[model samples]
Target: MSLVRVAVIGIGNMGAAHARTLVAGEVPGAELVAVCDVRQEMESWVSSNLPASVTYWQDAEQMMSSGTIDAVIIATPHYDHPEKAIQAFRDGLHVMIEKPAGVYTKQVRKMNEAAAASGKVFSMMYNQRTNPLYIKLRDLIASGELGEIRRTNWIITNWYRSQSYYDSGGWRATWAGEGGGVLINQDPHQLDLWQWTIGMMPVRMRAFCSFGKYRNIEVEDDVTAYVEYENGATGVFVTTTGEAPGTNRFEVNGDRGKIVIEDGQLTFWRLREPEPEFNQRFTGGFGQPECWKCEVPISGVETGHPGLIRNWIDAILNGTPLIAPGEEGIHGLTLSNAMLLSTWTDNWVDLPIDEDLFYEHLQQRIASSNTKKDKAGSSSQPADLSQTFK
Candidate 1:
C-alpha cells in the first residue's frame, strides 16, 4: 500500500483541522481523496482548501463508493458516529474514528463487530494515550511501583467553557446534538486516562450531575462521581465547566507512597526503601514513617495526538501496531455510560451497563432536549438562543 486514500466526514472545527493536516501532507501515505458533510456548503470549502483532485460530497455513502476510498475519518457529531463508521467498514474501508469511539457503548461495540467482520484496521482518536506523560504513568502503574493502589483522584476542572464556546455551535451542549457535557467534549482525555491508568473497570458507580448550573445547557455542566473497582481500589472524579483558573491534577496513592501529575509536572514520593524488621522492634508509636521523592527513569516519546495520527496512518499503510485499538474504544464510553446511568438512577450502578436501556433512555433525552440546531437540518436562530437562558 503506497498511499491510503482518505475521506473525511464532517467539516466542523476538528474535521476541518484534520483536512488541513492531510492537505498539508502531515500524514504521509495518506491522501484526502474526498470530504463529506450533510451541509452542501462544506463541499465548496473542501474544494478550495484541499487537493484539486479530492472530491467533495454531501452524502457519505456516495463518497465511499464513488471515490474508491480506502479509509475514512468520521468526525460527525457524537450521536451519528456509529452509523457512519459501520457504513465505512461495510464498504471495506479502514476507519479512524474521532474521540470516545462512540458517545454510547453499544454503538462502539457495533463498530468493533463491523471491523472484525470486515478484517480492516480500526482505530480510535484517543490521541492523549500517545502523550509521553500518560505513557510514562501507564508504564509506572503496570510496574507495581505504586504497590496495591488504594485511591485515585483526578479533578479536571481546567476545561472552562464560555458562552461563546457554547454558542459557537448549536450542537455544543444539547442532549440531542451531543450526548453529554464535560464527559463528552472535555473529558475524553480524563475518561481515557481513567481506563489506561487504573487498567480496570468499575464494579460500581454513583454520580451526581447538574444541568445548566453555570450556563444554560440541556445536559450536565458539572459532575462528581464515585467509582469502585473490583479489586476494591476506589476513585473519585470531579469535573465542571463553571470554574475559572481551575486545576488539572491526577493523584494516585498506594502502599508505596504516591505519584502526582499536576500542571504539566510529574512527582513521585517513594516510601523509605523497605520496611525494616528493626522498625517493628522499636514498637508502634516510637517511630514515624518517612519517604523520599524517587528518581525514576523516564520513558516514552515526548508526543501527543500527532504521534498517534502518524501511527494510525502507518498502521493502515505499513501494518504497524495501533496505540489505541478500536477494540478498546468501548471502555471509556462504557465508563461514561455507567456514570450517566448512575446519575440517572441515583444508585451505584454496576459494570456492563444495559445497552438497550441506555439507548432507550438516551432516545427519550434526545426527544426532550431543546438544542434546536442539530447538524441534521435543525435550525437555530443564534440570537434567539443567545437569550434562551438570559
Candidate 2:
C-alpha cells in the first residue's frame, strides 16, 4: 500500500479530468493504473491523453478484478454512484465517490453500510469544503462566536445552464437518468456546505420547486425551500439555474453576531452585547445592540477538485481524516430529496424523510418522463468543465 494504485470508472467530462489529474501525478502516493468506461470510443481517447502504462477497460468488473488497482474513483451517473461504490468496496478497494452520494437516501445508506463493513477509506467529492472562506465560517460557528443561530439564507443562482447544455446529454435533466436538476447536479456542494457549516439538519422542510421553468427538461430548474431546525432556527434556500449575473451570497444571523460570505469576501458584524441580552435590558424601544462591521481576513486559495483528491489520497496513505465522508453525503441528498418530495406531495416533509414515499414518487416521475431524442448533427461535445467549478 505504499503507492495506492487507482482506477477511475466512467471517463466522462469529470471522470476524464480526474484521470488526467492522476496521470499528471497531481496526487502524491497515487498511481493511475487503469481507467474504465462503457463507451469503446473512450479507449482511444485515454490512450492519447494519458500515459502508455495506463490501461483501459470497457467493463467495470474486469477493471476491478484485474488486480491492478487498490482503489476506485466512481465518477459515473447519479444512479450508478452507489452501485459502483458498493461493488468496489465488496472487492476490497477504497472508494472516492463524486457528490450527491446518489439520488436517494435508501440506496446511499446501503452503500455507506457496505463501506463501513469493508473497512476501506470512503470519501466524497465535496471540494467546496476545501475553500478557505467556508472553512473559516465553519470555525466561526463551531467556536460559538456567532452565538445561537437565528436564521440562515443562501441565494445561489449561479448555476446557469442553457437548453443546449440540457440537450448535450440524454441523461442531462431527465428523471430516469440524472434524477433531479440543479439540486442534484449543480448545487450539491452548496447544499452540503449549508448543513456542514450550520452543523445541523432541518427537522422539517417545505419547498416550492418549478419544473422545467427555464429549460425543456423534466426536473426542477428553480426552487425555494424553507427549513426548520430542532433549536427553532429557520433557513431559506433559494436557487435557480436560469438567472444571469447570478448571486451567491450566504448570510447567517445569530444572537451575538452576523456573518456574510459573498464574492470571495467574508464580513462579520460583531455585537458589543448579545442581541437577546440587549433586547431584554434595553428600556428604549428605539435602541438596539451596538455592532462593529469587520471584514474577516482569509488566506490561501480555494483549492477545488485537486485538493479534495489529494486529501483522499492522503487519507488512504497516512490515515488523515476525510474532509467529507461518503456516509455524510446522505444528509445533503436528504435535503434535496425532501425538497422535491415536498413539492411533489404539496406538503411539508419531515426530517429523516420517508424513503419509501420519496422513492415511490421518484419512480412515478421516471415512469412518465419523456425521453429526449437526439437530433442529427447536434452531437454533444465535451465542454471545458474547468470553468464550471466554483
Candidate 3:
C-alpha cells in the first residue's frame, strides 16, 4: 500500500493527541480514516475537532471490520491495549499500541504471540526512544565506550501531579482501573528507556513502593527500586509524582567512562584507562583513572509522538524497522510488575517474573480496589503536554 489508512481507538488525552497529529497530516503517507471510543460524547468532539471526512464509531470492532483502514492505533486504557491490539492483529491490520503494553505480562505475551502469528508490523508508542540524547546514550553504551558497567542511577521525580488530577478521572489511579500510578502511567517511557539504553534487563529487583503517598489514591505514587544486572552490575531507580522542583538525572558508571543525562544535555567522561586496569597497575594508594569530561553533541529534532507515528507508518508501508517493537515492551512491564510485586510481597522478585503469581496478585488488588467518585463538573486540567516530552 502506498498510503496507510489509519484509525485511532480511544479519544482520551493521548488518543486524542494522536488523532490530532494524524488529522494535521504531520505523518507522511498516513490517512486518518476513522476514530473510535466507547464514549458517545466523544463523537461530537471528534466531529468538531477533526476533518469532516473522518468517521466516528462508538464500537472499536465496528471500525476494525469496516475495511476502511489498514492499521489501528490502540491508545485505550492499559488493560484494553492487549485485547484491542490482539484483535487488530487477528484482523490482519498493523498495530501501534500505547505504552505499558498492558497491566500484566500474561496477557501482553498473548498479544505479542498473536502479532507474531499474524506477521504484521507491531509497534509501541515509546516516543522517548526517538530523542536524540537517549539515542546517543544508547549508542555509547552499546559501543562499549563505557567499558563494563559498574553502576546506574536515575532520579526521575519530576512527574508531579495533584489531587485534582486523580479526581478528574474515575479510573485515574486505582489498581483496578489504571493498574499503578507513576510507574504504569507517567514513567513507562523512562522505565523502557532505562533498560533500552543499558541493553540489559535486571536479573532481580527489590523495591519499596509508597501507595497513596502524595495523593488520595490507592496505587503507588512513589517508589525506590534496587536492581542487579546479570553481570553483577547494580542500579537504583527512584521515581515519584509527589515532588515539585523535582530532578531528572540519569548516570551510568563503567570501568572506562561515565555518561550522565540531565536537563536535555548529555555529559560523557572518558577515562584514559579502564578503572579495573588502573586499580591493578597503579602504585599510589589513592589514584583514579585520568578522565576527560566531554559534552556529547546530540543533533536531531525531538520527534515525540508524531515522530513515532510517522515511523510506524513508514514501517508498515516501506518495510522499515520499528524503534520500539511491540514484543520488547514486555521488558519494561516486567520491571514494573516486579517492583510492585516486590513491594506487595516484601521480598526480592526475579526477572521474567512469575506471571501467574503477578496476575493473581493483580487480580486481588483489582477486586479490592476502591475507586473514587468524580466531583460534579470537575475534570483534569488539559495536560500541559509540552513538559511531558522528556
- On TM-score, the candidate that comes out on top is 2
Q: How do the candidates rank by lDDT, highest first?
A: 2, 3, 1
Residues 60-168 of candidate 1: C-alpha lDDT, one tens digit per residue: 8877767478998887777667788888888889888777677788878888898899889988888778767777777788988777777889899988888787876
Worst 10 residues of 1 by lDDT: 377-386
Least well predicted 10-residue stretch by lDDT in candidate 3: 374-383
Weakest 10 consecutive residues of candidate 2 by summed lDDT = 372-381
What is the TM-score of each predicted model, taking all chains together?
Answer: 0.91, 0.95, 0.95
Each candidate structure's count of clashing pairs: 0, 0, 0
Clashing pairs in 1: none
Which is superior by lDDT, 1 or 2?
2
RMSD to the hidden true structure, all candidates: 4.0, 3.0, 3.1
Winning candidate number (lDDT): 2
Scored against the true structure, residue 140 in model 3 reaches a CA lDDT of: 93
Query: Where is model 2 more than 4 Å wrong at Cα?
Result: 372-390
